[model samples]
Target: MPATTIHLVRHGEVFNPNHVLYERLPDFHLSSRGVRMAQATARYIAAHSGLNHAAAVYSSPLDRTRETAGEILKALNSVREERGEQPLELTTDERVIEAGNEFRGKRIGHGDGALWRPENLRLIRNLHKPSWGESYDHIGQRMSDFVYEKVGEYPGEQVIVVSHESPIYSFRHLMETGSAEHWMWKRHTALASVTSFTFDSETRELLAVAYADPAAGVQ
Candidate 1:
């Protein structure tokens, strides 16, 4: 493994923060516990092995990523200060956001009249349109491209990426060539989970995947 270790950290829990569906809600923020958990993960990253060579930090454009990356940059900045170096600044890009779910911002309930209900099922029936929401294929490709581009451009320089679960997991799928349609986040990635990839600094190929939590882990 080379020094270009990419850390893919899923944002902390944002679902039902106020007991309401936060899908695509711009105002959604990390829960108090989520914030603390994110800070803890930041500390963990600061102590992690390749971060000393970190050259950049990128995040999804969503507020969740913005917040998570902010916490991480602060921690990494502290590391920079300790090492007598300049601070690490955080940058955001949209390519790392969660695969857009058609139902974003819309209410879903098992009740009779809700969109997920049989009567209004058509509201989410079209899964392939951006108008309906981004298709899984589209999201998967975008995420893969983003990862490939990152490592290809900055070989040997560690970079921390703050992203959503869908994109993060999808990148792994790209490697395994698995059926990415599966919504396996519950079984694979957990809220605030940190996943990592070590790429060959020269070829940009994956050499390993590391997990922060054994059970809620990405393979």
Candidate 2:
């Protein structure tokens, strides 16, 4: 039986001096340290024989995810060059993009335009369901559709997907527990972390799930 593995990688830290919620916002690139974080994770993926063999690299259609995917492509391409294989190119997908948020441009402090304003609190009453923005079910469904499509396209091969925290964790949580409703504060999807799901190509059965935080020590 042929088995396929899809590694979902979260984007590195963003260069947000104002610390505003930049969800799906334009021009929010990676910070200097964030670049290093992406590099660290890229090295981790390149050093692993299985990961270096990934057939395709994918990213959310956002600056931060694209930047992170760029670093991984550089490292993976180097390995491919050594192996006489064609270098992989990146494909950005909206399905794996950041969750839509009403608090997109709000800060987190106790200021006038902060995220914790009384008006904002009303929308955030249920942390698990998230009434303020995109629902967890929608996020999980989109991610699932993306992964299943890739599995069909690359059967038995490996692929890398760079995305945001909520999409990654929501999808994984859905796969693990059959429901995407999860505590936001309890998300284990760190920046530049890799969460892999291995499946039976013929049956599309999820065989295993694994996670790694290569940039945990970057700070």
Candidate 3:
């Protein structure tokens, strides 16, 4: 049984100049620092993993993720071509989207008096009830489905999933370690970092999960 090794990447920093909750905002490109972060992540992946064996790449449909995936491919392509190898292309998957934060489009606080307000978080925690948006449970179900399905299909291969915080966090929570209401607490995913999971082929279950950050353990 071959190992289903997947490279799950979070998208790079968005161009949130105001730094507001730019949820699902279309056309948000990578920040300058974000580009560098993507490059760093790509370099790390290239150095650590095998490009030729990577059968496919999967990413969120969002532009930020698409851009990030491109950089990873570029890194692999550069290193591989240096040694005379062809580059890999990425596939877009809707499964690994940003988890639906209930307070997606709404302002965190009044425009001038803006900050990470306590009330805003309260709103996000109870989002499943209809006043807000999708619940963490709802998001988790989708992520679990994606993880199982993707791994099943690409057994013994390497894949990349680039997506936003919510969906990816749901995946982490499902695969790494987290509860249903964990997102309610204060946890923010840094942009363009890589999160990976290695699954046991015989059981098709996750053997190990890891993140790039050394200081931060699983959220």
Compute the lDDT of residue 122 as modeled in candidate 2. 85
Q: Give RMSD to native, each candidate.
A: 4.0, 0.8, 4.3
TM per model?
Answer: 0.83, 0.98, 0.80
Candidates' C-alpha lDDT:
0.71, 0.95, 0.69
Query: How would you order the candidates by lDDT, starting with the best?
Result: 2, 1, 3
Alpha-carbon runs more than 4 Å astray in model 1: 1-3, 15-20, 108-115, 119-132, 185-187, 214-219
Alpha-carbon shift of residue 214 in model 2 (angstroms): 1.0
On TM-score, the leading prediction is: 2
| lDDT-best of 1 and 2 | 2
**Error of model 2, residue 175, in angstroms:** 0.5
Off by over 4 Å in 3: 50-52, 82-85, 112-131, 176-180, 184-188, 214-219
Task: Give the per-residue lDDT of model 2 (tens digit) for 6-88.
Answer: 99999999999888998988999999999999999999999998999999999999999999999999999999999999999
From the highest TM-score down, the ranking of the candidates is: 2, 1, 3
Residue pairs clashing in model 3 are 11-192, 12-192, 98-167, 99-166, 99-167
What is the Cα-based lDDT of residue 130 in candidate 1?
34
C-alpha displacement of 214 in model 3, angstroms?
9.5
Candidate 3: tens digits of C-alpha lDDT, residues 1-219: 677867677877677765566566678888877777788777777777453356677788888889988988887777778877677778887777765544555554566435456665555434333235666667777777887787888878777777776666666775656554453444445566666778875588788776774212212
